[model samples]
Target chain A: QKEVEQDPGPLSVPEGAIVSLNCTYSNSAFQYFMWYRQYSRKGPELLMYTYSSGNKEDGRFTAQVDKSSKYISLFIRDSQPSDSATYLCAMRDAQGGSEKLVFGKGTKLTVNP
Target chain B: GAGVSQSPRYKVAKRGQDVALRCDPISGHVSLFWYQQALGQGPEFLTYFQNEAQLDKSGLPSDRFFAERPEGSVSTLKIQRTQQEDSAVYLCASSPDGNTEAFFGQGTRLTVV
Candidate 1:
């Protein structure tokens, strides 16, 4: 099994709808969780970052991590058409001075007008 | 530009031909990373460098895949004899340090035919 697993959903929703994206990791040593958004022909852009387990909010995005369950989530409120992109979840262990990140397959989201 | 930059934007190579992709990281960044993103998948770590020193290359898939940050700035990923499976987007990212978030380049899309 892959270290990190995510449902590759081509989820389509209307504007203003709430979107929830999730990923589950099997590694227990992951301490840093991150969400990245990638558009066509572009690199992944960091959207939200969280340390260990807990919740973090930024603008219309909220990220949650549950170390106990090995799960992480990204919630988008008031989603817009501009939000259409691939959402990727990535994690890294706290192996001092190491910055390697393990990533999920990514879920494609499209918010319609 | 303030962001990381990758060259050739797109490359098409014949099977068994060698190819090299270049990345120019953000100025003054200390940590550089190389990743491979296959179609419909998330980016996977390939190698990492701390300045001119490659500290981790455990993610490289084969001996044909080689990366080097010769001057601790601009780095290159070279494939000795490319195969169809080598077709993917090569992403380069840089951070101020190991403890900070990374900034990524648009990436170079390589197609081996």
Candidate 2:
């Protein structure tokens, strides 16, 4: 099975809508979860990161992780056109140093005005 | 520079030709990583450097691919013989330390004919 899996959604939503992006992973050793936003011709940019199974909120974005279920999610409230980009889920092992990140196929989101 | 910088924002190379991509990571970052991103896929690990020492290279697809960070800050990824399959965006990232969040640069879009 792929280490990380995500739906490559060309999801379109109207502005001010609530958007949820999720990812599932097969690796039990993944301890750090991260969400990245990538615009066309640009590299992925770190949006949020969480280490434990819980919820973290930053402005209009929230990140949730469930270690037991091996699932993670990013919730964007009041989505904006600026948020239209590819959202990628990434995870890293518990190794303190020399760690590598495993990524999922990103979901593309478009917020129409 | 304040952020990671990758040169040659885009490149087109003939098949079987050699290509060398450069990455200048953020100053003082202890870890540097290289990744390849296809059109619709997330970034895939390529290689890593902890200072001038190459600690992990298992992610490299073949022996034809090599990366180096001679001074522990500036790094380069060299592809000996480019193939059509090698057409992808080469991304470079750096972190203050092994366990810290990483910052990525705008990738180099490579097109191998």
Candidate 3:
């Protein structure tokens, strides 16, 4: 199985809708979870980051991690057209020596007016 | 520089040609990483450097790919005899330290014909 798995969603939603993007990992050693947003022709931009389990909130975005289930999620509340982009989930273990991030296939999202 | 910068924002090369991509990371950052992102996929880790020392390169796809950070500030990724499969957007990211949040560059998109 791949280390990280995310649905390649071409999800379409109306403005102001709540959007949830999720990813699951098979590697139990992963300790840091991150969410990135990428627009076409640009690189991925860091959105939210969390260590271990639990949840973190920043403005209209929230990130959640469940280490017990090896799953992670990003929720966008009252989404806007500016939120239309590809969301990527990334994780890395606390190996101390190496911090290479493992990423899943991103989910493409489009928020229409 | 305020952010990570990559050169040759777009590159097109014939198959079997050798190509060199450059990355200028944020000043004083201790960690530098290179990732490859294919069309519609999230970025995949390729290699990492801690200052001028390369600590991990386990994700390099093959012997044809090589990366170096001679002065610890500017890094370069060189692909020898590139193939069509080598076509992808090469991204560079850097962080203040090993375990901190990383900032990415506007990647260099490479297309091999």
Predicted structure 1: lDDT = 0.95
Which pairs in model 3 have colliding backbones? none
Name the runs in model 3 displaced over 4 angstroms. Answer: none
lDDT by residue (tens digit), candidate 3, A1-113: 88999999899999999999999999998999999999989888999999999999999999999999999999999999999999999999997689999999999999999
True contacts kept of each: 0.65, 0.76, 0.83
Flag clash pairs in model 1: none
Model 3 gets an lDDT of: 0.95
Per-residue lDDT of model 2, residues A25-61, tens digit only: 9989899999999998888899999997999999999
Residue pairs of candidate 2 with colliding backbone atoms: none
**Best model number under lDDT:** 3
Clashes of 2: 0
Over B45-111, each residue of candidate 2 has an lDDT whose tens digit, in order, gives 9988999999999899999999999999899999988999999999999988868788999999999
Q: lDDT of each prediction vs. the true structure? A: 0.95, 0.94, 0.95
Write the residue-wise lDDT of candidate 3 on B30-113 in tens digits.
999999999988899999999999999998999999999999999999999999999999999999997988999999999999
What ranges in model 1 sit over 4 Å off? Answer: none
In candidate 3 the C-alpha lDDT for residue B28 amounts to 98
